[model samples]
Target: MTDHKEAITILGKTIHLGESKELSFEVAKLHTFNSVEVPVFIERAKKPGPTILLTAGIHGDEVNGVEIVRQIIEKGINKPKRGTIICIPVLNVFGFINLSREFPDGRDLNRVFPGTLKGSLASRVAYKLIQEIVQEVDFVMDFHTGGSGRFNAPQIRIIKGSKTLDQLATKFGAPFVLYSKNLNKSFRNTCHKLGKPILLFEGGKSFHIDNNVTIHGVNGIKRVLHSLGMLATKFKISTPKTDCVFINESKWIRAKYSGMFKATTPIGSFVTKGDFIGNITDPYGKFNHFVKADNTGYIINVNELPIVYQGDALFHISKELL
Candidate 1:
């Protein structure tokens, strides 16, 4: 006999989430526009445990997270040994199509969460997702990356003061755990309000895939699943060595002059205030603008490309005070 179809009731319609197969559901129905539904499922292992929601591709340009999820599900690392794993690989298809960060309506889906039923396209998607998935999950792991020309260290961001979330994040064993205060309109904040602990992993950059980062992300997710007892695997994930510091202060060092950029400091390097981070030189190598750090801190992210415009953010620094 065929396995019983794992299913969820949405819009009064029973959507089948085949026990061990990838499934897609239409989030929006457009006649002239080609759009598909959101994909969700329960990778149950015939045991009982906590439910974990894995989301990626909320920003279309940050495609690395989507690829990370795909690799995990397709490679069998996401095979749950207990509870369920709900994986949404692409949350913004329109943004993904043109390799952009926002939806077709130019809205950042991550910034508009717990959205409205009768709102804009982004709001509608957020509404359906919240109703159909978020409300049903025990824990959430949202994936993200630096959007368009920015790069981030492979790190996990947990809401400040959430001991449970922080503990869970440290267990995931990512290289760094950043204490991020919840913004008013972010997906993490919405989930926090709903009492669901969500961990956000950020790395790579838009339009680029770092193979090592993808692997690290997948492994981290699996480790979190294991820690929650949703997987039977006994992978020993590490706890943070020091108290994860709160990244309460951060600033983007912008290019004062537009020219060809040459980065002098690399990501992960510590810099003092007023130190040169990079240089912007003209095509003929005559005029040059020196970019300097405004604060003393560890560089968490930097733009690798050798190009810049006035006001372009070249480096991101999180205050070391914690």
Candidate 2:
């Protein structure tokens, strides 16, 4: 809780206490002289509390997070009882518009941290976010999804060695929690450097919205808010019966040969070493090649696309904590 009260400003607009507004920050301009902006939804409570930031659509194709954030806003999360909730439903406007994963310049937005004003499009946008949004938040939740043709089981990826982040992830109550190394130039690393706790939720697949994943994400956010004493009233926080599996390491199963692939095991399935994960058959049905797990682990991500090439990532397996 903060005793000192002051108005929050963004995009040159001042948001007073107990007020909520939809604002946009201009990030770039189009060839037609139109402006492209990042939409920000702010909800400041009448009472003081920790400020939490929730962002989605860092990769434009990841629509699950975008939809999750949208539902939270529609459910009136903006009308908080205490503290503030800042939601940026879509961060990469250019990628979102084109339905692509990265910026138009082919740079992954997630790989550019604390960007520079004079840098490329992705870098500039990252810079603006770091300067204007990330720096002010006490906590953050960045949502993500698997790449195209891959489905990731709903899970929380927390940074290693941060008890604060781990506790928040536990309160968030995702089915799986993985302690992952912070990637260089990623938002998670940048926030960690600034001494802010950030939790990343990876689920579903890019360009598609899975209802179960979306619902879980929405509830997880609320649970975290309640845990932080930012939620105004008490509501039944959803808890899964299955214990969350904590893992420190994961590996990907790659295709051994190119063919039309069919996965026999689904996402979230547990498999033993050498267990058949899928079978790849020639287009004409002349030959078949079986894909097997290299280690005993839980399948967190699986490729959904039927076509496969040699060395293509087919499954992501995470070793459960003993």
Candidate 3:
């Protein structure tokens, strides 16, 4: 990054063995007519092995994901010992440029999969990715962060009942692994349909980069590469601080009333049923409503936004564990 020897063709460029190249493909242009190209970084090892593709920034505001990929490139982690490593730090260039979550056309890139040739901009880009890049990689690792003001504890998401994914998620060693069904038309679903094993990582929140989340992400990548024998000898793998938890089910704690909300509980912590965890208050000297835990489970996500409304998701708590 695969079904080839000595060389691989990406965007019509033939990259031979042990050769590293920065190639890009044109997607669209700005209003000024300047061409916009999405860069693809490729690094191949002299000895042949499986190819792994690392990607992020499908949602432009998820800068933390972009940072993780950027660190891989910056630290030469993309240089594999025996296999090919491809890093696409930013998949949605338009969204990244505008610091927005969706494409310029207001379409979510993750919702379009195996896109059509003559579709919307995001769809076209998705199609190109599948046809040109996804077909070449043996495996994939996509990075993401929470949307809105929600901050997520480092975690991996995969469909339930996959032994292979369970092993990989354990190897990833994030604090939590949540079993979830794949969304229709999602990239993960498309890749799974094509027989590609992919890991989806979610952490932190949009527009903000947290140190702990970044370290977890980078370490997870190194662990996966090391498992494949692709990690460089110079890089040392770090042991995870704690055993990863497998979540079989989870529920969102929604706001009961609209007000300025503040969470007293931290992410990734367990709480008993009806425990006081947060509060809601008005700007003026008004009544303060104390929020309680819905059940006894780990809080995986917390909405950090100060303002809230009725029915707003406040926290994500595990409902069942494996």
Candidate 4:
């Protein structure tokens, strides 16, 4: 049903942006009430080739990725040489509207992939996304941020067993390439199962945009596109050669008791199994508890807030060694 002559169409209409193009994409209705219409932007070449999909707002609070995709399209880099690039800047439109992390029905869209036609709100959205975007693409790069009450080191997540994804991860130019062997029912997992390598860029926190992270992410995506032969650009410099750590095991340090907490370890700091990381203290300093590391690794992520509750995750410790 694809015609090379009609390179661009939106909602069954041929849209001519002179230089910029837009399309109205749709997601299924929630509770059988209303459908969510989304915007899709593309820059196509007259010649046909591979298709790349760029998606963000999977978690509504991850605003940096949304802005990064918008800026990339708005800037209009070197035109595609052999294929097309489709950017879905916002995927979870309903969660994005309320600045929430989950769908209105409290479902996580990322957890439900290749969803059902007769399912919950999150499942329906997943089905529509996979149907409209995933099935038609050769490559995918989904963007994300930290989850609720968490912060992440700038990293890319790639499936561990694939040589193609491993090389693609380095092409992204991120400092850390997190080898996520979990393979949960995530978008990346589903795409990998279907033979499409997807790279996930995780940076900063939710509901806020970090300029540095955004710039790095955009640059990384462009670099990958160029590597994939989709864009014509001179390779100015070789990608930084960093040994990827296979992190198969990690744990979260939680508060032993509820109190005002103070952190002593900074992110990316190395630690031993029994090192004191922080403390919980009463207002009058009458009762104090010391938080210590239970594993030998680096502090890849930690809580930024001083206030905490019992069983609250305070730090994420993982080893990037082997």
Q: Which residue pairs collide in model 2, if any?
A: none
What is the Cα-based lDDT of residue 297 in candidate 1? 83
- Give the range where candidate 2 is weakest over 10 consecutive residues by summed lDDT: 1-10
Model 3, TM vs. native: 0.97
lDDT of each residue in 137-249, candidate 1, tens digit only: 67888899986578897888886676797678767777667776788778888999988889899988889999978977977887777676665565444444444434656
Return the TM-score for candidate 2, rounded to 2 decimals.
0.95
Query: Model 4 segments beyond 4 Å from truth?
Result: 1-21, 28-35, 182-184, 232-246
Model 2 ranges off by over 4 Å? 1-4, 320-322
Q: Would you estimate the TM-scores of all the predictions?
A: 0.87, 0.95, 0.97, 0.84
Best by lDDT: 3
User: Largest TM-score belongs to which candidate?
Assistant: 3
Q: Candidate 4, clashing residue pairs?
A: none
- CA lDDT, candidate 2, residue 83: 84
Please list all clashing residue pairs in model 3, or write none if there are none. none
Question: Ranking under lDDT, best-scoring first?
Answer: 3, 2, 1, 4
lDDT of 3: 0.92
Q: What is the per-residue lDDT of model 2 for residues 67-118, given as tens digits with 9 covering 90 to 100?
A: 9999988887645678888999999878888889999989999999878989
